[model samples]
Target: MAQGVFAITEQRDGELRKVSFEAVSEGRRVADGLGADLTAVVLGSGIEGLAEELKKYGPDKILVADDAALADYTTDAYTNVLAELIQSSDPAVIITGASAQGKDLSGRLAARLDAGLAMDCVEIKLDNGNLTYTRPMFGGKIVAKVEIEGSPQIVAIRPNVMDIVENSKEPAIEKPAVQVGDLKTKIIEMKMETGDKPELTEADIIVSGGRGTGGDYAAVEELANELGAAVGASRSAVDEGWRPHSDQVGQTGKTVSPNLYVACGISGAIQHLAGMSTSKYIVAINKDEEAPIFSKADFGIAGDLFEVLPAIIAEVKKLK
Candidate 1:
């Protein structure tokens, strides 16, 4: 029988990702509910120092898989090591962040392990000594509750959805020795984003612009800067050549679940909503009162974003 919960953590350049903490924290909660120990498994080269950080998230044990080949993220390399570890450890549940890497890794890992996987889960509940996962389906039109029938249930949770509670446990650290076999892919180069601005998927607050911005993002950037929020764009804005594809928030772009999502100059098409509909609080600013975005916003401002953004920015500055 599977004995414990395993959180497969992701790291880059020997630093722990935000999702790693969330995965471990949520794993801790599930482990406590299931009356099992929680182990966090970190994979990267020279990441042993991360064990102390992982311990603060309440894992009973931390397993570090450090190898030169594991320094960069390659799908086959991570899947091979994790699949072997899971087979030997026999964890009852496996949790990973539903970020880009997490989603990719979990799907391949589940296939290799032949386990049922719940992807992009927003809520995980303990149901009668088992786990039930809630995730959006059909382009965020409907939410579905999913449960796995077999052991070592794999779940990839969306970033920023789970709270990062510090549980602080004196976890026993272990260095897992595993061979990273031949890989089909290799990282030739990496283009790192240059800025302190948080990534869209992990941002706590996001301020986004759309077609209404008229190819000018000064107002949107101003408000986002004042609120310490990441800047996002709709597909129209990106298609219009006003913003890069990385800044787009829509079904075709990145999925974000920030604590606060401010949609400025946006008409809120269904495609755009599919990416950020899971935000905790939504504020929509649009000239048309009947814009679709207003229906989902917690607060609606039926006015031109160009005229409205300065006022909001000023208020945020005053509050700060």
Candidate 2:
């Protein structure tokens, strides 16, 4: 039988990612709602310091699995370790970030544990100790609230939807002895993609361009750089080769819940809104006043993006 909720925290480059904190925060809220203990699992190479960092988030327990082979992200290694932990701990709920790495790990963990998984959930709530999850369905046109029917419910949350709150409790650390096994796959080479701004998934502010820019992304890029925002693209722009697929922000692309989302030259499509509509603030710059994006935008600018973007960039630079 399961006892409590556990949040599996993800880390990279020897530090914890923001999504890890978001998972922890979500776990804390769910656990409190159910009157259950909230625990966190930190797995990485040379990560003895992570326990103290996660303790500030009010986790009752911090389970640490540190090993050299676990330094870099490997699907096989992580899946094996997490599956073993879940089998032993028997947590009622397992929450992870719906990030690139998290998505992969959650699905594998679900298969290993034979548990039902709710992916890319925007909200999670516990009703009478039952886990209810809200996830997008049918290309994000509709949202479905589902209840997991088994022990150790698995959930992957979209980044930034949940706020990471700091609690003044010191979490006790427990070092778990993991059995190292032969790997079926080995990570031979690794490449790091460098960008001046933060990743779209993790950025606080995002400025995105679409097909309306007529394949000229200079204005959009300049404005994003001026505002210290990450550059994002609608699926149309990405498919048209105006931007890389990695920069695409839409239901079929990356789902971003940034603090501020600025859409330029992009007509608001339902799929695009599905990814970014949850942002705290949304600003749309387009020539068409009747654009559907303006309906969901907090602020609207009816003008050519080429003209509006430069002015906004100049003003932002002056303010800075």
Candidate 3:
């Protein structure tokens, strides 16, 4: 019979992503519910030391595929090796983060394994030894509960939505040797995003600007600096050449669920809300009181962001 809850952990540049812990922790919960063991899979070159970190999240065992060819993330290499592992292990459920890498790998892996996949899941529940996933539909207007039939159900969970619980376990670590067949693609060069600010998906706090900034993000950046928050921009801001596409948070861009989201001069389009509506707390600043963002915000400031931002920055500075 198929058994074990398998959590696929993501790592980049030999460091585990924040979502890796969350996937393992959530897998632990499901394993407990289904009376199954939780196993975490980490693939990278020279990443044997990462087992110590995964053990803290309660995996009963960890399979480390330490391979030089698997160092960089490619679609073919990861899918081939992971498919072999899953076929041998026969896990009942497989979980991965909904980050860019995870999203890409899960679909390909599902097809290779002929498994059902639930993408961008926000909530996972165990129902009578089966798993049901809750995911947003139609651009966050509604949520749909999904269930996969058959063994080895695959799920990709959204980042920051799942809590990382520490359930220490003395997991048996195994270094597995697998053949990573010839790859279809090769990385010639990688252009990394350089910044001190936390990644938008993993950030605890974010301050975003919109078309209301009139193409000037000076005040928004200053406020973000004072609050120690990552700077984000709306789609309109990005289309206008005010900010790069990477900085945009919306349906067409990266989805973020920060602890605190401060919207400056944004009119809160539904597409924009689809990304960050799950933030723990929202603060919107716009001159228009009727702006759609205010309806979702915990606190709304009906004033010019230029004037309101400096005040917020000063107050934050005083607190610091």
Candidate 4:
């Protein structure tokens, strides 16, 4: 028999990611709907301090695994800790963010636990006390709702899709006994990408460029800096060597759901729209009025990005 809902809260460098809270919020909703308690699982070294912060999102219990072996993320170490926790708790449903780390962890955990896993879910709800998850399929052309046949249902939610609410609940912190007995992998070295702004997948506002900018990222970079937004690039721009593939936003790249998305010089391809069409507000800047991106944008500016971006940047600065 399964117990309740368990949400895996992801943390990096002793700081909790916003997606962690969003997962907790979603898990709580499902737990409430099913008349079950919500429990949060925080795994990593030096993360005991985050227990109080996780409680604010309304979990009934906070499970922390503090150990040196868990400091750096590896599939084997993380999967081992999470698998042990899930086996002991026997949760009816487990949820995690559909991030790079989440996707990797969830798959391995599911395999270890022999549980059905749903990936990249946009929405999760209980239909008459049964868990049903909705996700994009066939290249965002179709939406599919899935349900696990047995107990311990697992899901990985897409970032920025669900609303994260601070319910102000005081969660009881419980430290779980983590068995770190001889992991197969050893982390000898780790390198992290440095950036000033939030990650593109997690940013509230994102400003992106495309080939129409003529390989000069100055206009896009300036506007992004002024707005304190993450910079992104289209497939065309990335392929042209104007930007790195790490910043690419499209079907083949990162999917983002920012509060606002500003697309400059990018002709909106279906592949690109599949990634960021869920953004709350879209502003398109292009010289061609007939561009496909204009149709999806809430605000459209049919003009040269070089001319429009500078003025917009100036206006934004004045307002600030």
Candidate 2 ranges with C-alpha deviation above 4 Å = none
Model 4, clash count? 0
lDDT of 2 by residue, 1-320 (tens): 68788999999888999989989988999989888899899998889998889988889999998988788778888888878888888899999999989999899888888899999898987678777899877656688999988877899998878888998577778889885566887887877787668899888999999988999989888887887889999999999998988999988988787899999988988888888877889999999999999999999999998889888988988897
Comparison by lDDT, 3 against 4, better one:
3
Residues 1-320, candidate 3: write the lDDT tens digits: 99999999999999999999999999999999999999999999999999999999999999999899999899999999999999999999999999999999999999988899999999998878767899987667678999999878999999988999999999999988988998889899989878678888888999999999999999999888877799999999999999999999988987888999999999999999988898899999999999999999999999999899999888998996
Better of 1 and 2 by lDDT: 1
Ranking of candidates on lDDT, top first: 3, 1, 4, 2
lDDT of 4 by residue, 1-320 (tens): 79799999888888898899999999889989999999999988988999989988899999999998888777888898888888888999999999999999899888888889999999987789977899987656577988888878899999888989888788888998898666898778777776777789989999999978999999899888998999999999999999989899989888888999999999999999888888899999999999999989999999999999999999999998
User: Which is superior by lDDT, 2 or 4?
Assistant: 4
| Model 3 TM-score on a 0 to 1 scale | 0.97
Clashing pairs in 2: none
| Model 2 TM-score, all chains together | 0.95
Which of the predicted structures, 1 or 3, would earn the higher TM-score when compared with the native?
A: 3
| RMSD of model 2 against the true structure | 1.5
- Superposed by TM-score, candidate 1 places the C-alpha of residue 213 at a distance from the truth, in angstroms, of 0.9
* Best candidate according to TM-score: 3
**Number of the top lDDT candidate:** 3
